[model samples]
Structures are given as structure tokens and as C-alpha cells.
Target: MNAIEVNVKNGYKVIVDNGIFDKIPEYALTLADYTTVTIVSDSNVAPLYIERLKKGFLRANKRVLTYVIEAGEQSKNLSNYAAILSFLANNDFKRKDLLVALGGGVVGDLTGFVASTYHRGVDFIQVPTTLLAGIDSSVGGKTAVDIKEGKNLVGAFYQPKGVFFDIETLNTLPEKEMINGFGELVKYGILMGGTLWKNLLSDNLSLENCIADSIRYKAEIVEKDEFDNGVRALLNLGHTLAHSVENLSGYTVPHGLAVGYGIRRIAKACKNNGLLQNSEYEQIINVLDKFSLTYIAPFSDNALIRASVKDKKAFADSINIIVINAIGNCSIQKFKLDKLGEFFND
Candidate 1:
């Protein structure tokens, strides 16, 4: 098992391995310092892993409560967040209690939001089930829920107490989910550059090593800019268009797939504007092709522009857009959302 320690205002550890779910209770006690735990999962996930966790906590002599929300992007909303906070309140879950987010990005995000706000922040643990969470969102303290206007517009930078990633859980994910994760991995490779990017171009990509490296690389960056104030904005590489695509699609588009298109869209625009070189642009398309995640957005360019303006990262008339200068190298560019239509017209 490999573990990466994320040093932030509230320091935490991210442990990655194949079968660590069996040790959730043991690790929770060590990281959270709590006797009570609330394991929040989605309906799609609880049926698969909840029983084992419930039993694990029982054998450890700890009180365990379970909350299962409907599974999907739509469930990450204010109503569900309120219900979870109410659940904790009704159960007398105090600051000392811990929250274990036991699913993909949605569960981790919503649970983290609840943990961050309920009584002004409680310790939360992440047991990421999907490749997306394990590789990216699970480790970052960015917690949020979607509003009608935009995705993740309401949230906080609440750090988790610990993150336990069991690659075995990812084995059961649908192929689409796996591809969704690859999109985020592509983002990391683009941002950090080097071995990860090289591996992506080859046929022999190591999933385990790629997962750990991405987490470690991101941990280092997050440590330097935990608040998304400066360098952290680079992480939003494809997410600006991704969030808008998701919102405009009414979220039928999976985040990873949307991100794939987001990356492509941004890359195309950058190339047209002479911001990204032709060779690097070809490489980006090839990487997307290898993953079989290429898909065109069904929404109008105008709608996409409007949705993007609502992005939380937006300031004044411009948003900080992550642009690729080359493969394994990128920069943050402030672009006017009003001019987004020109990119599409190109």
C-alpha cells in the first residue's frame, strides 16, 4: 500500500491500495479519533459495500449509521445536503463523529460538504469507489453541491481527515466510468507533464502507478495553493467547460466524458487562437481517441458560453481558463466569457 500525506491547514493522509476497504474502521479510528461514524453512500454503492463496512464497524465496537441517497449527478443538491445535516443532528452526531464518503465523486463531494458545514466542520474520510474520485476529486478538499445555475457553485474547501482508496472497488465500475476517470488522468498528465504524459502515449500504462503519481503530484500542488487562489487554478484544466456541459445537459453527460469534450473544446480553441502548437494539439486528440471518450456536446455554443459565465472561478467578465501551451505544459489564461462564442465559430 502506498500513502500520500497532504499537508494543508488541516493535514490528512491519502492511502492507496487494492483491498483497503476491509480496514476502513481501523483506519477511521486512527485518522478521525471518533467512536461514532456515519457512512454516506449512494443507492448504487451501498448495495455493494455497505454490509461489509457495517460489520467491520460492529466488530470494532463502534456505532455506525448509514445514509444512502439516490445515485447520480442530480442528487447532489441542497435538499439532500439538508437531509444529511438533519440526520446527523437527529442522531446527535457531534463534532467528534466522523463521516465516511463511500462512493464516487458525488458521494464524496456531498458528504464532504455536509461534514464541512455541519457544526462548522467535522472530520470526514473518503473511500472513493470510482476511478474519478480516487485519482482526483477524493484527495482535493473541494466539496460542493450543484445549484440550478451551475454545478458546484455552492461549496467550501473543507479538508478530509483521511482518504482510503482501494483499487479493487474500481474493478466493478462500468466501462464508461473508467473512461470518465481517464479524462481526469489526462488533465493531470497535461498539467504536470513527464512520465504520466509519456505513459499515456504508450500501450503499457500502469493504472496503479498512474493513480498514485497523480495523487502525489496533486497533493504537492494543493499543499502550495489550497484555496484555489493561484496555482491551484491550473487543476481546472477542462473543468470550466465540463461543469457547464454537465449543467446544460441537465447532467445526463457523465463528468468524465464531459471533461473529455471539455478538454477537446478548450484545446481546439487554443490551437485556433495560436495559443497551442499543432503537434501538441494532435497529441491531445490522440490521447482522447485512445480512451474512446470523444463526443460532441449537443448544446448550442451560446448556451455553453452562458453556463460557463456562471462558473465559480469566474471574475468580472473573464474566467481563469487553463490553456495548454504544449503536452505536459499549460498556463492559466483569463478569457472573457463573452468571447467564448468566437472559439466555436473558429
Candidate 2:
């Protein structure tokens, strides 16, 4: 197992490896002395791994409860959030008990939000089953559910007790979900160009190493800017526009795919504005194509801008966006709410 330590509230280790689900109880015991564990999964994942997890925890002499939500980004809403809280309350769960997020980004986000708010706060760990969650949402303590207005508009920065990545889970994912993961992988390659970018270019990377490297880079950034008041926002390299793509699609577009589209859009805008060299722009486009991340939303530039303004990062008059100055390097740029047209206009 490759362990990457993220220094946050108290600090936690992100363990990445194949078939690590059986060892979760040993890891959880180190985080806290909890007696009960509620494994919150999604419809798709519950049948596959819930029993395995429950049996493991039960063997460790811990009370185990399971709650499964409908799968998809659509499930990350206030109604489901309320339902889970009711499940916890009805079971008489205490703050000392634990919550285990046992699915992809949706399960992790919703479960993490519940852990953060229930009883003021409760202990929870992330068992991210999808590539996107394993690389991005499962770390960094950014837990949230979507509101009607926008994605992740209602949530908190509640850190998980620990995160475990079972590479085996990726095998059961649909081809589209696998594609969804590559979207974020491309974002990491662009942000930290080096071995990662080169490996992505050659497609000669091991999945475990790629995941560990991404988590390590994010760990360093989160340690530096835990509250997202500074450098950490760079992690949003393609998210500003990605969120818009998701919103316009009514979230039909998976987030990682939207992010891939976001990165392409930003790179194109930068190239036209002479901020990015043509050679680098082509490199970006090529990598995206290699991953089959060539999705294009039907919306126009003006429509994208309108949708993006509703993002949580948007201010009353301005919003901060990330722009790639070069491959592996990005900087946050402030755009006046209306002046975002610069990203679309030549």
C-alpha cells in the first residue's frame, strides 16, 4: 500500500492499493475509538461491497449499519441529505460513532457532509470507489451536496478520519465512469507537468502510482492552504467552467468529463489570446483526445458565462478563475462578473 499523508485539521493518511478493503477496520481503529460504523453507499455500489465491509467491521466487534442512496450526481441534494440524517438519528448514532463513505464522489460528498453537520460533527472516513473520488473529492476535506442554485453550494470543509482506495473497485466501473476519471487525471497532468505529464503522454503509467502522485501533489497544496484562501484554489484549474458545463447539462455530464471540457475551453481561450503557445495548446488537445474526453456542450459562450456566474466561487461583482500559463503551471485570474467574455471573445 502507498500511503500519502495530508496535513489538515489533525492530518490523515490516504492509502492507495488493490484489495485493501479487508484492512479498513485496522486503519479505522487507529483514527478513533468508535463502536459503530454506518457505511453510506450508493445504489450501484451497495450490492457489490457493502456486505464485505459490514462483515469486516462486524468481525472487528463493531456495530455496522448500512444506508444506500440512489446513484448519480442528482442524489447529492438536500432531500437525500435529510434522509440520511434521519437514518442516523433513528438508529441513535452518537458523535463517537463513525460514518464510512463507501462509493464514488457522490457518496463521499453526501456522507462527508452528513458527518460534518450531524451532532455538530462526527467522525467519518472515505472509501472512494471511483477514480475521480479517489484522486480528487476523497481528499482535501471539501465535502458538499448540491443545492438547486449550483453544485457544492451547501457543504463544509470537514476532514475525513482517513481515506482508503481499493483499486479493485475501479475494475467494476462502467466504461463511461472510467472515462470520467481520466478527466481529472488530465487536470493533474496539466497542473504539475513532469513525470506525470510525460507518463500521461506515453500512457505508460501504473494506475496506483498515478493515484498516489495525484494525492501527494494535492496533499502538499492542501497543507499549504487548508482553507482554500490561497494556493489551494489552483486545484480548480478547470473547475470554474466545468461546473458550468455540468449545470447546463443539468448535471447529465459527469464532473470529470466536464472538467476535461473545461480545460480544453480554457486552453483554447489562452491560445487565441496569445497567453498559451500553439504547440502547448495542441499538446493539451491531443491528450484529451487520447482519453476520449472530446465532449462539447451545446451551449454558447454567453450561455456558459451565465451558468458559471452561479458558481459558489462567484462574487457579487467578480469571480476567480484558473488559467494555464503553461503546461504544469496555472494561476488564478480574477474576472469581473460581466468581463468573463474575455474567455470567449477573441
Candidate 3:
């Protein structure tokens, strides 16, 4: 159990670990005496590891329920969210019950949202199956379902009891998904300096090693600031335009890819704003290129700019963007949507 404790605002401890599934019951036992467990996963992951998880929970003499949904961003909607709630309702899940989110960000977000609202909130655990979930979504406790208006429009800040990250599960991930997740790992390197960034660029580092360190890096930040009131916002390094691209792409582009392009665009924005040097921008682009991330989008500059204006991070008059001043450090800057096109044109 390679666990890093995240001290959240509501006094929740989010433990992020690799291969911790073997000790799931033991971890839950330590958290609460919940008699029932609901494992919420997607179609892709359910056929693979749901039984193993269910059996483990059953071994602890607990009643376990499994809820499987279609795997994709499109499934993260009101319909699916309602289904999860209905399942919990039928099962008579109480506050003492445990809600286990077992899949990627989509599963985690949807399940966490249900756990947050169900029975006025229940103790939940994150069994993040993808590299992106392990590194980013699972640790933050920001759960939500997407609305037609925007992404994560309906959600809450519900911290999980723990996060179990199994590196072995990542072997089954599709290459596109892996590359998409690698974009998020790179975003951490761009924001939080230290060995994590170094290991990401190191040729000798393996995916397992990167995943472990990335979880640790995020766990450290979440421990200090669970909410995005301050430093936590730095975690949105590439998310501003990424969300816009996701909306404009009609949910066709994956989150990781959109975030990858958003990172590059933000770097360009920073360079134009005199925050990042030309060499720094080149380095950012080079790393993204090395990861095979798509830095350019299919939309026109005007379309992207228009989409960005509707971003949730955008305030009344200015859009809030997280920009890297240099490698390992980042800050949020407010910019006018009209001038954003200059960054792309520049």
C-alpha cells in the first residue's frame, strides 16, 4: 500500500496508492464499519476488474453492488447520474455505505457526484483505473456531471475517503488513452517542479514510476489546499482552453488531448503576455510533441475564442487562465476574450 494522505477541507483523508486494491477492505475497515459497498464502474473496466474488487469487499463480510455504465465522456450526463442514484436508492445505501469509483475520470466524477449527494453524502473511495484519474481527477474530490451548457456544470467538492491506484490496471488502457493521460502528467511537470518533472523527461522512467510519482505530487498539493481558493487553482494549468475545446469539439476530442492543446495555447498566451520566454515556450512545445499530443485544434481561431468566453473559469469581463511563468511554477491570469485571438495569431 503506497499511500499518500490528502487532508481535505472537511477533514477527509484521500489516500492515493498503486496496487492498493489488494488491501481495499482493510483500508475501508479503517475508515468506517460500512456493511454495504457500491462499485461504480464503466463497461470497459467492469468486465476486467469489477469481480476482483467485489470479491475483495465480500471477503470482509460486506454486501457489494456493482453499477456499470457506458465508457465515454458522453455517458457522464444526467441520465447516468440518475441511474446511479436509483441503484443506490434501491440498494438502500446509507451514509455508512461505501461508494467505490472504479474507472477513469468519467467514472470517478459521476460516482463521486452520486456519493456526494446520495443520502446527504456517503463515504466514497476512488479506484482510479486510468493514468489520468490516478494523477488528477481522483485526488481532487471535485465531482460533477456535464450539462449541455458546459462541462462539470453540475457538481460538488466531495472529498473521497481514499483513492486506490493500481498501475497493473493501466496495461489494459488503449494507447490513445495513455497518450491522452500523458498530457495531464506533463501538465503537473509544468506546474509542480521537483523530481516528478525530471522523471517525466527521463528516458529511464517507466509508466508505473511516473504514475506513482504523479499521484504523490498531487496528493501533496491536495493535502495543503483541497479547494481551489489558492494554490489548488494551479492544478488547472491547461484546463481553461481545454474545457472550451472539449465543448467546441462536441465531446469528440478526449479530455487529455484537449488539455494538451490547451497547455500549448496557454504557453503561447504566456509568451505573448511577456510571462514566458521564447525558449520556455519552445521547450513546452517540444515536450508536448515528444508525447505526441495535438497542440493545434481543428476549430478556427475565432471559434475557439468564442468558445473560451463561455468557459466556467471566465468571470464577468475577463477569462481566468492558469499560465506557467516557468517550468514548475504557474499562476492564474485574467485576460479579455477578445484579445485571446492574438495569442493564436502571434
Scored by lDDT, the top model is: 2
Model 2 pairs in collision: none
Instruction: Write model 3 residue lDDT over 188-297, tens digit each, in one string.
Output: 87887577767766777666656667776787777777766777777888887787788887778878889899898888878887888898788788778888886578
lDDT of 3 at 319: 78
RMSD versus native structure for model 3: 2.1
- Once superposed on the true structure, which residue ranges of model 1 sit more than 4 Å away at CA? 298-303, 337-345
Cα RMSD of predicted structure 2: 1.7
Q: Whole-model lDDT, candidate 2?
A: 0.89
Whole-model lDDT per candidate:
0.88, 0.89, 0.81
Give the per-residue lDDT of model 1 (tens digit) for 67-87: 999999889999999999999
Ranking of candidates on TM-score, top first? 2, 1, 3
- Candidate 1 global TM-score: 0.92
- True-vs-predicted CA distance for residue 56, candidate 2, Å: 1.0
The list of candidate 3 runs beyond 4 A from truth reads 11-18, 223-225
Estimate TM-scores for all models. 0.92, 0.94, 0.92
